[model samples]
Target: MRKLIFMFFTVVLAVGVISAQDDLSGLTGKKAIKKANRAFNTFKLNQTNGGDDLKEARRVIDYVVKQDDTKEDPKTWVLMGDIYNGFSSFNQAQKVLNPDWENIEPNGGMVAFQAYKKALELEAGNKNALDGLSQIIGSISTAGLDAYEAGDYMGAFNSFRSILDIHDLLKENGAASPLDAEEEYDNQLYITGLAAMSAGQNATAKPFIQKLYDKQYDKPAVYDAMYKLTIDDDVDAAEDVLTKGREKYPDDLGLLFSEINHYLKLEKIEILEEKLKFAIEKEPENPSLYSTLGNVYDKLYQTNYKEGKTEEADKYFNLSKKYYEDAIKIKPDYTDAIYSVGALYYNKAAIVTEEMNALASDYSKEGTEKYNMKKAEVESLFSEALPYFKKVEKLDPNDRNTLIALKEIFARNNDFDTSNEFKMRLEKVESGETIEKSYFQ
Candidate 1:
C-alpha cells in the first residue's frame, strides 16, 4: 500500500510540471495576449514582485510573437518590448542588492527600441508603441547623463548613440521625433564624439567629429580634437583641418597652437618659419604671433645645434632673438616675450657652460683661465636674464614657472639666499598653499 501511494504522488507531480510548462503554448490568439497582459500588469505594478510575472510575460509573448495570427499585431510587439524592458529594470534593481547580477539577456534598451520601432512601422498610429518609444528615448538620454556624470564615458557614448539611433528610426517611420532634427543631430554628434574620444574609442569618434566639422561648427576645440585624432595616422589630413580652422577662425589661439605643434612634430622648421611669417602678415600687430615665431626659432636652434650645424644653430638663435625683440618692441609689457628672451639667454648660457665643462677641469692653470672667461660669459648671460625675470616677477608675481626660472637663475649666479626664497615660494605654489604676497613685492 505504501509503494502504491508513492507511485500515485510521483505521477501527479509529473503531470503538474508538464501542465505548467505547456500552459502558454497551449493558448493561442486572444487568449495568449490576455495571459501576457496579466503578467505584464503584474510586472508593471511592482517590477520586483518576484521574477515569475516577467518570466510568464516573456513566455506568453515569445509564444504569441511567433504565431501566425499575432505575429503582425502591433500590440504583440508592444507587449514583447514591455516585457524585455521589465527584464532590464529587474536586472538593474537586483544588481544594486547583489552587485553580481550578470546580465545574459539582449540589451534591454536596444531590444525595446527595435521592437517598438517595428510596432510603429506596422502602424504609425499605435499609441502604445509611440508612448513606449518616447519613454525609452528618455530613459536612454537619462542613462547617458548618469554615466557621463559618473565618468563612465563608454557607457555614456553607448547610451547617447542609442538615443540617436532611436530618433533616426522614428524619423524613418514617418513619425515626428521629439528632438529638433538639425540642432539635436549636431549636439548629439558632438557629445557622442567627445565621449567616444574620452573613452579612447578613436575610430568611433572620427566620423562624428568629422560630421561636426563638415557642418562648420565654428568651434576651435573641435578642430583641435579632430587634428589630434588624425595626426598620428594621417598627418596630411590633420594639417588640412588645421588650415581650414585657421582660415575660418583667424584669431583662434587653439588652432594656431595646434598648427605650431604639428610643424614641431614633423620637425619642419623652415615650413614653420614661413607659416608663422604668413600668420604675422595676416595680423601684423599681434604680438603673440611674433612670440610664437620666436619659440619656433628657439626650437630650430636646439635641433640644428644637436646635428653639429653650429653656423645654422647660430643663425637660428639670431632669428629667435630678433623675433623676440620685435615682439617686445611692439608690446613692451608682453610678459611671454619677456620670459622667452630670458629663457633664450639662460638656455644659451647653459649650453656654453656644458661645453666648457666637457673640455677642461677648472683646477689647471690654463683650464682656470678658460673656466673664468667662460664663467664671465655665462654670468653675463644670467645678468641679462635677471632684469627680464625680475620684470616678469613684477608682471605676474604668482606665476610658478617664473618663480622656478628665478630660483634657477639666482642659484646659477651663486646668490643662494634669494634662490632659497624663490624655492620656498615655488614649493608653496606647487602644494596649493598660499605664499606671502609681500614676498613678490
Candidate 2:
C-alpha cells in the first residue's frame, strides 16, 4: 500500500512540473505579455547584481523575445536591441568576470537600426525612427573608426558603406533625407580622395578634392591640399585659391594672415600693408596684428638701412618698437615680441655709438669738447638698450643667447664690472636659483 502511494505522488509531481514549463514556453494574451514584461524587468534588475545572475537575465530576455505572440511588437524588437547592446557592453568588459555581456552583438545595433527602419517602413514619415536610425548609424561609424585604427580597413569601409546604404535606402523609400544630399554623396568622393592622396596619385585626387572644396569652400584642409599641389612652382595658382578662400571667409583672420604672408613672399609690400591694416582695424585686440605690424616695420627698416637712408631707417625702427610694445602690452607673455624689442634697442645703441666714434675720430681738434656731448648721447642710447637686455636676462636668465648679447655689450663699453655681475647671475639662474625682476625706472 505505501509503495503504491509513492508512485502516484511521483506522477503528480512530474505532471505539475510539465504544466509549469508549458506556461513559461509560449506566453500569450495581454495578461501573459504583462507577466513576461515584468519577468524581463526583474531579470534586467537582477543582471545589475552581476555574477551568475547575468546568465539568468539573458535567459529571461531570450525567452521573452522567443514568444511568438510578442515577436511582431515593435517594443519587443527594441527590447531585443537593448539586450544585444547590453551583451556587447559586457563583452567589451570581458576582463571583468561579472561583465554585462548582452551588448557585443552587431545584430543588436542592426536590430535597433532595423526596428527604426521597419518603423519607418510602416509609417513613412516617422521622425522617431529617423532620429533613432541616425543615432545607430553614428554609433556604427564610431565602431568602424575603432576597427580601422586596429588595422581593419575592410571593417571601416564596410561601416562607412553602411551609412551610404542607409542614405540610398532612405532615398529609395521617399523618406526624408539629409539637407545636403549631394554633399552627403560627396563623402564617398572624399574617402576616394584620401585613398588617392595616400597612394601619391595627385592627379586622380585633384578632381575629388576640388569637388569637396567647391562644396565646402572655407575648409582649411581643402585649401591646404590645393596649396600643396602648387607649392613647387605654381605660386599664382596658390594665390588664386587663397584669394577665393578669402572671399568665402572674409572674416577669417588665419586666411587674412596667410594672404598677407603670400603677398610678402611675392614682394607686394603695399598690398601686404593694406591687408595688415585692415586686419588691425577688424581685430585691434588681436596680439598677432600688432606683431605682424612690427614685422612689417622691421622689414621696412631693413630695406631703408640697406639703401643708406639713416633717418628713414631710424624712423622705421622706432615704429617697429612701438608696434612690438603694443603687442607686449596686449599679451605680457609674448616672449618673441619681448625679445624683438630687446634686440632692436641693442641695434639702436650700436648705431648711435658708431656715430659718436666717427665724430670723435674725424674732428680731433674739436674733440674733447664735442666728444663729451656726443659720447653722452651715445651713452644715453646704450643706457636705454641696457634695461631691455636686463629684462630679457631676468625673464630667461639661462638663455645663453641673451647672456652672449649682454657680454658683448658690456665688453664693448668697457663695463667689465657690470658684465661679470650678469655672468654670475646667469650661472646662478642655470643652477636653478630663481631670478627676481630688474625693472628700469
For model 2, what is the error of residue 113's alpha carbon versus the real structure, in angstroms, after optimal superposition?
A: 13
Task: Give all TM-scores, in the order shown.
Answer: 0.55, 0.56
Q: Write the per-residue lDDT of candidate 1 for residues 300-343, one digit (tens) a residue.
A: 89999889999999999989988998999999989899999988
- Encode model 2's per-residue lDDT on 264-378: one tens digit a residue: 7777765876898899988889887888788788888878987899899989888888998999899986767777787776776666667677776665667766767767876
In order, what lDDT does every prediction score?
0.81, 0.65
Q: Poorest 10 consecutive residues of model 1 by lDDT?
A: 17-26
Model number with the top TM-score? 2
Count backbone overlaps in model 2.
11
User: Which residue ranges in model 2 land beyond 4 Å of their true spot?
Assistant: 1-136, 142-180, 183-209, 215-233, 263-268, 352-378, 421-441
